[model samples]
Target: MMSRIPTDAIRACVEHTGWTEQEVRNVLGNVIAETPDALLEALPEVIAWAKRIEDSAALVSIMKELPRGVLEITWNGTEPAIRIRPSCDVRQVPEGWEIVLPDEKRHAST
Candidate 1:
């Protein structure tokens, strides 16, 4: 039987990133399925990224473009970065900031 997704983790993601509950579930579900604790484990970095960006709408758009799988948050350098397995392509928004997006969204109407 499949295990349920953790509500606390979902809440954290939603609170920090401004993504709807279903969006959070879609983004993190695959990773949580592979590793039950993955969402909780990654929550800190996710929150950090959200705080660093300080734009809920942008974060929501970015999350929407990510593939439906493991969400990877990295802090190996001066800033935090997020990506998913089989990394997506990136494009610059009108504000001149680059953001990653799945292939479909790469050319879809913004």
Candidate 2:
């Protein structure tokens, strides 16, 4: 699999979607600059595809229905047909329990 980021493709996707180019760049500017063209092209397509089915309400339903478990993505070697399954087992973390983490590990929280 290619490991480079596709800057041009990402820009095109952002532009096509009417999102501010500067905002997207501000978020992924550095990585996009270093990404491979092929990867960049693929990334935008993936984003567009994801947006088509971006169902926050469905996600909330899933979370409510399976409050005890976690969602797992099962890759099927396809470009955009990945499956997300909720774990059979309940969440490892108990309800009402807070997870502690170091301040340095705060990245990706958003």
Best-matching candidate per lDDT = 1
Model 2, span 72-94: residue lDDT tens: 44446753232333213223465
TM-score of each: 0.35, 0.28
Worst 10 residues of 1 by lDDT: 27-36
Which residue pairs in candidate 2 collide? 4-36, 5-35, 5-36, 6-40, 68-91
Alpha carbon deviation, residue 65, candidate 2 (Å):
20
Candidate 2 minimal-lDDT segment of 10 residues: 82-91
Query: RMSD per prediction, one decimal?
Result: 13.5, 14.0
> Candidate 1 at 42: error in angstroms?
2.0
Give the runs in model 2 whose Cα sits over 4 Å from its true position.
Answer: 1-10, 26-35, 53-110
Clashing pairs in 1: none
Clashes of each: 0, 5
The lDDT per prediction is 0.60, 0.48
